[model samples]
Target: MCDDLQVSYPKDFKWSSWHVSCTCFLMMTLKTQSELITEINNGQNFSSEASENFIANTPGNFNAWLSENRESLEKRKSKPYFLEENKKFVK
Candidate 1:
């Protein structure tokens, strides 16, 4: 069950351990660590657009860049690209 579902569990489970098997089986239906990481990466990629836009909208000079893109940068940071993504697995 663990291997099929790609999860971590105790390897020394004894024979006739129905509870262990049941728990492991139940865990199989849940998302794995790799799945969670993949979800997070997708979120970061989604947010990267905001970051890229911030860089693109900046002026040539540092102060001008900060002044010009301050609002947009903050708005981008506030966007819950990752939060919205993680919420998908909330069920």
Candidate 2:
């Protein structure tokens, strides 16, 4: 899954039981709407134009925005991006 997502780690990095537990916890957890929006805006998953359009269209209504883009967001979240992004914390 990490390879499929193109999330690479250091060649010397090793996955321990703690790392696996943390990864599983991250995958199973539900992120808040704000966290999702922030991630979408900050991430490379969506183009700048798309992010701008989402913000413009939503106008502070994250719930509505989430409802409209739930599937895409879920797909994005399912990727190993979080593992890569939060690798420091995991380590």
Candidate 3:
């Protein structure tokens, strides 16, 4: 929502390119954190096979990683430095 794209949420509120969103104003291509990680690893952000395995399944693998890291991630989200919308909900 903070980004340039205007988003609208419906009752179900589960539309997503990678994560959740309901509607989008402009044509937007959103990438999951896993995808970004995969790209970075492939492009030499860090050279390792670990990143390869980590993002091998695209959204599913990254989503699992998110589940695994939820507690620490919640703590990070609690910080004021995070976005206001994210402050309301962890997702």
Candidate 4:
């Protein structure tokens, strides 16, 4: 049938309704939004000295360097350092 061909139907095709279930099933194989955000944030903690060194080596604007690395920095910002002194005693 036409399904055996690699061609796709127009977006407005009525038959596209049937593909919705298949799409949803495939989507389930990927991580959810919150999990993806958490994974990217966790990845920031592992950025290497080489990465920082690369940014430092850039010839122009430091702001551009920051913009390029913003996602990594944002992820790094989300991590909190735990220390004994920072703990609050519950009354």
Candidate with the greatest TM-score versus the true structure:
3
Give me the displacement of residue 42 in model 1, in angstroms: 58
**Candidate 1 accuracy as lDDT:** 0.35
Positional deviation of residue 43's Cα in model 1 after best superposition, in angstroms: 56
lDDT of 3 at 65: 51
Clashing pairs in 2: none
Candidate 1: tens digits of C-alpha lDDT, residues 1-91: 2233232222221223222335433221234456557768887333322321222221234234335655775677463232233333212
Candidate 1 TM-score over all chains jointly: 0.19
Q: What TM-score does prediction 3 earn?
A: 0.23
RMSD (Cα, Å) of model 4: 22.3
Q: What's the distance in Å from true for residue 48, model 3?
A: 31
Cα-based lDDT at residue 9, candidate 3 = 27
lDDT of 2 at 39: 77
lDDT of 2 by residue, 1-91 (tens): 3222222233233333232334431122234566567877988354333432232221233234435655775677463444355444332
Off by over 4 Å in 1: 1-60, 78-91
**Candidate ordering by lDDT (highest first):** 3, 2, 1, 4
Runs of candidate 2 with Cα error greater than 4 angstroms are 1-60, 77-91
lDDT of 4 by residue, 19-63 (tens): 223432111123345555665888833323322222212223323
Over 4 Å off, model 3: 1-58, 77-91
